[model samples]
Target: MTTTDADAVRLVLEGDAEAFKILVDRYYDRCLRLATHLLGAGGDAEDAVQDALLRAYRHLGAYQERDKFSAWLFRIVVNQCRTLGARRRGVQALHERAWIEQGDGEPAEEHPADREATREELQRALSRLDADQREAVVLKFAEDMTYDEMAAVTGVGVSALKMRVQRACKRLRAMLTETNHV
Candidate 1:
């Protein structure tokens, strides 16, 4: 049987520390993805996620069962990213390569070099976005989250999140167009 998140949390709180690893294992990839998009670099994102996961473990006692554990943990990740991102601003170049490379092991449907160029172009455009807008876009589209779920993680109102996404999309399109023309 599949163990639910709530069950894992209960096991952890009930003194089974190893149970916590289950929770971490389940959510680690998602947390890393969010952090990577928010922080805009794999190394920074990894550091932020490690700190966030540590903080989550330390504060596990305060976690209430009423809230979904993923949302609660994501809030921590978002906050950590914000703190790290502020510290990193101005020190990191705007055009730094920010994505983590992944291979699916399937035969290539598209030319690898062309795919890489397209990916780099998109990353450049994303890096140009305001942090808030980028977060909104990443959560909405990249992470495939609903507005309600995003609001829970980000603590931003649904309408505001919608506006950010709309603006981000418009900006990304313009930026991508400008790049293609050059």
Candidate 2:
């Protein structure tokens, strides 16, 4: 965590209620990106992140000083994403199909067609993962969080977080390979 984050968290805990905004501004986009990666686009990711922020605010007093603020915030976001993912599972198939179809019509940017295809393939593979594995992968890869930080956020042992990430990577590689994307 940065000194700024630590300072903001300390200020919030000390009852300078508005100091929480600094932490919010610092983390909000990263949290949204994590949620988007897990939830697979559209507005659900935004909703999940917002809900997580609210939950974190409400529970601020319970936060342990020993814990990294980022990890604690991530835990709240991941939980919110998991809940939203479960509720939306039934509609995901339709959403995925529509997303792919719509994507086909868009012009590719600087990235090559194959690159775009690979990215989409990875996204699909990620979406197929169980919630825990997906969360582990996103936190490790996208957030660049250490195993200890992930463990703190996930309430799992470091070994377990490593195992989850390993399994998630293996599954994603296999899925991508099967799709001829790798």
Candidate 3:
């Protein structure tokens, strides 16, 4: 039988240290995806995810049973991403820089032409969004979390998260429309 995160946590707390691997295996992909979008994918994103997981493991004892485990873990990842963002201070992402530098060169290795173009346009729009809006949109759409879940993860009021996502969607639509029209 597959172990739930709560079960894994309980086992880990009960001195079954190896049980933590279950939690790691369960969350690795989802956490990595969240970190990648938040930090724009590179060593920084990887480091942030690693640090977040480490922090989660170390603080496991402090984790309250009342709170959802995923929310607890995601909050740590968000904090790590925010710390990395603050350090970067508006620095452009490696992918963005590459897109500029390689303008007429061969397209990125895998993404087909139209799909890649659309994705690039979306990434540019996402980058243009402020951190709060970006987080809101990513968590909402990319992670497919509901408002309540987002609130639990972010500690922001539901209304505020709604506002952020609404604004982000409007901006993304406007930007994509402009690109498509051109």
Candidate 4:
């Protein structure tokens, strides 16, 4: 039986702490995907997700009923990503500069490895995007979220989120095409 997020929350508040597992089970994969895309599937990415989940668990009582549980949970995840991004700002800046200078990066050093190379190219291109554009793209395309949902998670205006997504799409396309992966 599919449990509603509100029902799960109510169960937890009613002293059934195990009920919170429903929410975590439902959202964990999605949260991990977003975190991996944003932080490139490394320890940092996993750490960001763990930190967000911990914060959500600790502050579950503070979650107001008005917002969708996902929006609130994702807000926590995004904020955690932002903090990680800031800490790794210099590394990302260097990577972005190198991406632009190299024009889609060096060759794969092996020709027949098509799918893995394509995925790697996409990951690199995604990492080169500014933090906001990366988050917007992950939310809008990868997560299939509506603009308002994205805005709720990000606390950005819908128009701004739209602009970020549009720009990200354009940049991603340009990078992929340059790499001959598109």
Query: Global CA lDDT of candidate 4, please?
Result: 0.76
lDDT tens digits by residue: candidate 1, 97-139? 2222123433224355576676777777777788888888778
Per-residue CA lDDT of candidate 2, range 73-160, in tens? Answer: 9889878988886332311221122112222454323245466555666666666778788778777777778898888877889999
Worst ten in a row by lDDT for model 2:
90-99
Comparing 1 and 4 on TM-score, the stronger one: 1
Of the candidates numbered 1 and 2, which has the greater TM-score value? 1
Least accurate 10 contiguous residues by lDDT in model 4: 90-99
C-alpha TM-score for every candidate? 0.82, 0.78, 0.83, 0.79
The alpha-carbon deviation from the true structure for residue 128 of candidate 3, after best TM-score superposition, in angstroms, is: 0.6
Model 2 alpha-carbon miss at residue 68, Å = 1.0
What is the TM-score of candidate 3? 0.83
Model 4 C-alpha lDDT per residue in residues 19-71, reported as the tens digit of each score: 98899999998887777766765687779889999999889999999999999
- The Cα local distance difference test for each model comes to 0.77, 0.73, 0.77, 0.76
State in Å the error of residue 48, model 1. 1.1
Q: Rank the candidates by lDDT, best first.
A: 3, 1, 4, 2
